[model samples]
Target: MERSLAALLVCVFGVTTGEFVLAGILPAVAGDLEVSIPAAGLLVTAYALGMIVGGPLLTAITAGRPRKPLVVGLLAVAVAGNLLSAVAPGYGVLFAARVVTALVTSTFFANAIVIATSAAPAGKQASTVAKLVFGMNLAMILGAPLGTWIGEAFGWRATFGAITACCAVGLLLVARLVPGDQPVTRSRAFGEFTVFRNQDLVLAIAITAVANIGLLMVFTYLAPLLTGPGAFAAAAVAPMLLVYGVGATIGNLIGGRLADRALLPSQLGALAVLVVLLVALWASPHPVVTGLLVFAAGAVGFSVIPGMQTRVLTTAAAAPTLAIAVNASAYQVAAAFAGWLGGRVIAGPGMTSIYLAAALATVLGIGLSAVALRRDRVRVKQSVLR
Candidate 1:
């Protein structure tokens, strides 16, 4: 079981790297593709759009397949997609490759989460999920900075090529280490929607979306934001991102433990921290202050992931795989919307607009959580009465 989890974590690291690696190298991509920086930023939107469409669809199509092979197959596809990206001749080709890559990436998350939670010891679902998600934080820590440096030193294409190699290594490790051959029970495509009947599930998803909107709005354009006002030199972006990555790792670990003890409180506390961090991030302009705020933003921003995912999974226990897939899709939808919204703000009201807008979005998320908590209490009281 430990080996399986380790393999899944490595696999997740590769996919997560693919997702956020673009952020650090956005400017390099824009220059290479002869497009505007915002245009390059839209690559994040494109990938998110693909995940939005593919998460449920691919999960439905591949339902009941043998689990281990399914993961390996998806990783192979990711390898191909990244390879295409590495050799893309223009913006259009790279855009197509990103969409294709995201389809596999979203499906991989659904499968891997189901596998991890199932293999986990009793009462450790959130912790196990956090462990898998640690790969994402790790990617942010290592992959994003390394990819950024590679893009600067070599070229953006070289960054993709390096990711391609990582995906291949992940593919091999999964096929060898993840021990599973059990086939899922055949499931109808439409059955995935049954989880939505529960209002708690719906509310949990909404919270996820709203929270992400706040994080990604500022995060998607962080490279430029750091460089814009001489807040950091061109060479300093990677180190700043590395700092954020470290904070993210710490937050994810603490969030998992807190959620295992009390889901609602963990989420609320994280959001509260985020509100403060976003304000500081916007108001502070000094290099030291901005760097510290960036690290805090990363820490506070990601601390709710385990709680949020655990809430959705428990609420939709009847359709765990599909529900997990839907939550993954929700994240992508949030990313796509936030990335596009950030681009629009960057174009019009200027870069500073993103932090303020993100802070307001987080306040809305807090309101949604209050409503959800109230509803949960009412439901519990009714159950006791019955």
Candidate 2:
């Protein structure tokens, strides 16, 4: 909609690309650095850990400054991080570089939510946040595939180099298009957590975490799932991911619109669909069927994201930015947890177990969403009577 919002979206796209491009190139990185695959996986783990720590910390530290400059500065950090990764001589250097990138990633991700909501028209705030989130999904859909292609064709370093260039473009757009606005000076760090005292907000965040656990559980192991015995050929992975990306793009737009129209019902339906889809993915025997189910899983899982975000915004009206930022951090925490859990399952039982666990988590998320809806209705009735 707004030029400023578009600029922020560009920044989000670049940040997301920089953050996740490593997934597609991990094998190359492992080979190049002479590390095991599990160890190379630490690059993703390290970034998530950084985000878990950095999101709230940076949100609080920058609470007193202007948002535009802070966002621009964070993008600069992302650019530098990617550049460092491109030139890393060893696994340790790459890991450190990922952490640095995540620090900026956390700050930028949280602040973008703040800026989007602030810039939107009164009733469209949640929709604005969803549009920014669309950039994130698109990055996964587009960035990872493209990065993998580049990595395969050139080298993993080239993928990182390309991301560095994208970050540069994002920085230039932020500088040119984003309006100069002072940050919300009244918002404090822990003040946002007060929303947790509201049962609906707490439930909403929990639902978000649960939903993500399901999504990331499968996603974290997608490559291996596709390449393992009875799985799709290596040549099919990129094409299947392209299908998944399309589903993700559609899901993001649908989620935003549904949330804008009817938040609770949309969320409930999405969670239910996600649970069913995950179960179906676990049950599918054929590789093509599994690939299609993966696409369905992406569609349904992402379709809930905007609704969950809007639910938090509505429940925590007092500190929307802090709540949203904290929620972003929560998602990363969920991702890290999901990755760990999925890894454990893969090591113990198999990849199928990850989807089974995800399905169970999605069911739990549905129950949480129901509780949140009931709590919100109770609050509304009380306010009306008052």
Candidate 3:
């Protein structure tokens, strides 16, 4: 149990660091590559797009195979991608490297969730999944800030180098801890799509996507938001991010417990909190207040992720791995859309508009969650009657 948990943490830390380190180094990348900041921002978007595409595709292709080799292979690819970026001659090559790494990272992330949940003792599945996800939030707290500091002090390429080292470490851990034999209890990859046909699962994914859209809309522009007028200085951005990470870590732990106790209520409460917090952010721009709200937003938004995953996994019990993988893909796709939306809103109105849009999306997500809960209750009653 300890080894499996450690392995999951290592994989998640590596992948999350690789995925989010870009956000902290965007400015440096822009200057180094001689591209406009917005243009350089495409690196983040490209990576997200890769995840959106890679999650389901890679999972389906590797269905029923031993997960260890696939995870190690993906980590190797991530390391290579970061290395390529570290040495790439120009923006184009760096962008390509990010895309490749993103695809590999997505596979690793989805598989990590599957492995974590499957390895957990039956009743403790949510908690196990939460521990794995905690690594992701931990990356935001520790990895992103450290990457930002390194990129600022040394250079953006140094951030990639750091991620490469982390990936190497992750590969070693995975080899040692992950089971050598493939678990072949289920070979129903195609049937996993049946999860989509289930209204509850469909609504769950839809709300998950909507919630992420709002979350990422603000997240993609968080550095800018913090560094803007009346906000924190550029140097303070990392610390603020650390606070957000704290919130996310708390959320991950609390969310798992909440889901284990009462899944739907936890989901609804998290979404509602997110909506309120985002609206508050839109209304207030004070650095101290905004920072707290940002932390709250991270805490509330992330709290739903584990619960959502649990819901989908339960709904598609026969093919939990595929269901979880597809849900992971939905998250990235929503992130891509949210980033684009933030860019659009930033272009039109300004940074403040990003939060406003996010707040609106959060409200929509809350409504979706409410409907899902109602539907679930009705289904439960029907099952009891039958």
Candidate achieving the largest TM-score: 2
- Model 2, range 1-386, lDDT digits (tens) per residue? 38878888887887898777887789999999999999998888888888878776776666656788888888888899999999999989999999998876766876777777776776676577778988888788888778889999999999999989988988898888877864465666565556568766777777777767877887777777778743788888777777877887778787888888878888889888888888887778888788778788878778878777777777777666566667787898888888789888888988667778888877777888888778778978999999
Off by over 4 Å in 3: 31-36, 185-195, 223-235, 285-287, 343-353
What TM-scores do the predictions have? 0.89, 0.90, 0.89
lDDT per residue for candidate 3 within 1-386, as digits (tens), equals 67977976986887788788887789889988899999998888888788878777776666666787878888888889989998989999999998888876656776777777776777777777788888888888888888889999999898889888888887898888878764543564554555567777778778778877898888778888778743678888767777888998999898998888888888888888787888888887577888889889988888888888887777766556666777887888787788779988989998888887998888888788888889878988999999
RMSD of each candidate relative to the true structure: 2.8, 2.5, 2.6
10 residues in a row with least lDDT, candidate 3: 182-191
The segments of candidate 1 whose C-alpha lies over 4 angstroms from its true place after superposition are 23-42, 89-93, 152-155, 181-185, 223-235, 343-353
Off by over 4 Å in 2: 187-196, 223-231, 285-291, 344-353
Error of 1 at 218 (Å): 2.1
- Report lDDT (CA) for all predictions: 0.84, 0.80, 0.81
Which of 1 and 2 is the better model by lDDT?
Answer: 1
Q: State how far residue 261 of model 1 sits from its true place (Å).
A: 0.4
RMSD of 2: 2.5
